[model samples]
Target: MTILIALLSGLVFGVAFGFLLEKSRVFEPGVVVAQMQLRNFILIKVWFSAIVTILIVVTLLRELGIVTLHPKPVLLIGDLVGGLLIGTGMTLAGGCPAMIMAQIGAGYRDAWFVVLGGLAGLAAYLTLELLLRPLPADGPGPLTLAGLSGTPFPALAVAVGVGLFACVIALERLRPWRLDLGAQADGIHHDRPGSPRRP
Candidate 1:
């Protein structure tokens, strides 16, 4: 019964996430690339909001004893290097793993190429495992500000969430999107690359 509940919850969350991605229009190649180039702030706003939201929710669940916190030990060097590679690939491909799926759902035939490239990269990583031998075996594990400062996780999460929210608001005020909800009516339109204007 627990397993079934988990599966159902995953399905519901997955659909909701995809819906949000599509509605945000971040699936558009131009919009994704624009975020990478820092000409637009929508994607960052969404990313930070999602992260903070999850953090806060999970923290609450933990506090309520509904969920236990079990963070995995992370290899600092490995994660840093891997993150750089993934970021570079996303910049070149104009979409990340989740965004690629959203793009395909939006009838972007080009997203197939990105998917193929991702598969190829995964294959290469598995085959070239020996090349990653230099990754540090022992490194600092998860070190959140709460852990470092001896603050409660809920308090830290709430503070981080508030800071991120303020940043998003400031960004929106500074460089507002030209077309808000009206952009959706126009289809998946996007402005030229590097321009501050957006769909």
Candidate 2:
């Protein structure tokens, strides 16, 4: 019963997350590619906003004893390699895993190929897991900023969340998101003649 409840809760949150992503239109291929090229700020804005929100929620849950925090042991080499691979794939596909799902929901025909490619990558990783085992060991044990800094988790969470939220606001002020969307409000490039192109 507990497992079922947890599954249902996860399902609800997943739907809500997808709905928010769709409403923000950050899952659009143009926006994703623009972000990869550093041509826009919408993707970062959404990411920082989500990070702040999750930090606050998780902190509150921990304080109320509703959830426990578990930091994973650091595996520097594996993390670096995995991040590089995923980043490269995202740049090529113009969408990350979550965004790909949202893209499919938004009627993008190309997202199917991204999904297949991800599956192929997963298979490759599984096959290489044994050979990569030696490089996976990196750190002594689990670590967290709070533990390293000798601060309470709640305090650290609040400080980090507030700082990120401020950054989100600043980003919005610097680049009004509408400008990132072409004049037609679509993701495609539609620069006008004599208009200055942003670097």
Candidate 3:
């Protein structure tokens, strides 16, 4: 039942993603690349807006007793290592996991490789985790950014909010697309590259 629910939720989210991607007209290479090049700041603006919204919503909900925030461990070293690996992989692949799925939805046939790569990555993570189960539970217990900073929860949240706002402000003034999303698509769409897209 949990598996079924998860699968259903994934499908629902995929449909929603498609609807929004189409509605926003952001699936177009021009939009994605423009955001990347700092030409248009759609990516930055939307993400920072989302981060701020989530922070506010979660904070209010926690204060209202409508939700519980179990502060998770902040393994700074693990995070730094994982982020570097993921960043390198993304740079080489020219697309992250989410973008791969978006391309697949956009009728890109080569996304199969991306899907395969994602599955392989997931499997490797699971395998490594199982092999090294002793480190996670025993190593770091209930670490948080606040714990590191000795700051109150609200202070940490405010810091995060300010950082997000600053990033959005910085992105709002970018010029135009420098790296073509379609080119990064890696021959995914054989049609007119960087063409004016309607859908």
- The most accurate candidate by lDDT is 2
Which candidate do you rate higher for lDDT, 1 or 3? 1
Ranking of models by TM-score: 2, 1, 3
Query: In candidate 2, residue 178 scores what lDDT?
Result: 79
Clashing pairs in 3: 39-175, 39-176
TM-score of 2: 0.85
Provide the clashing-pair count of each candidate structure: 0, 0, 2
Better of 1 and 2 by TM-score: 2
Model 1 misplacement above 4 A: 1-12, 178-199
Candidate 1 Cα lDDT to native: 0.76
C-alpha lDDT of all candidate models, in order: 0.76, 0.84, 0.65
- Taking all chains together, each candidate's TM-score versus the true structure is 0.80, 0.85, 0.68
Write down the RMSD of candidate 2 (Cα, Å). 3.6
Ranking by lDDT: 2, 1, 3
Which pairs of residues collide in model 2?
none
Q: Write the residue-wise lDDT of candidate 2 on 26-107 in tens digits.
A: 8888888888888788888889988887888888889999999889987788778879988888888978888899889888
lDDT of 3: 0.65
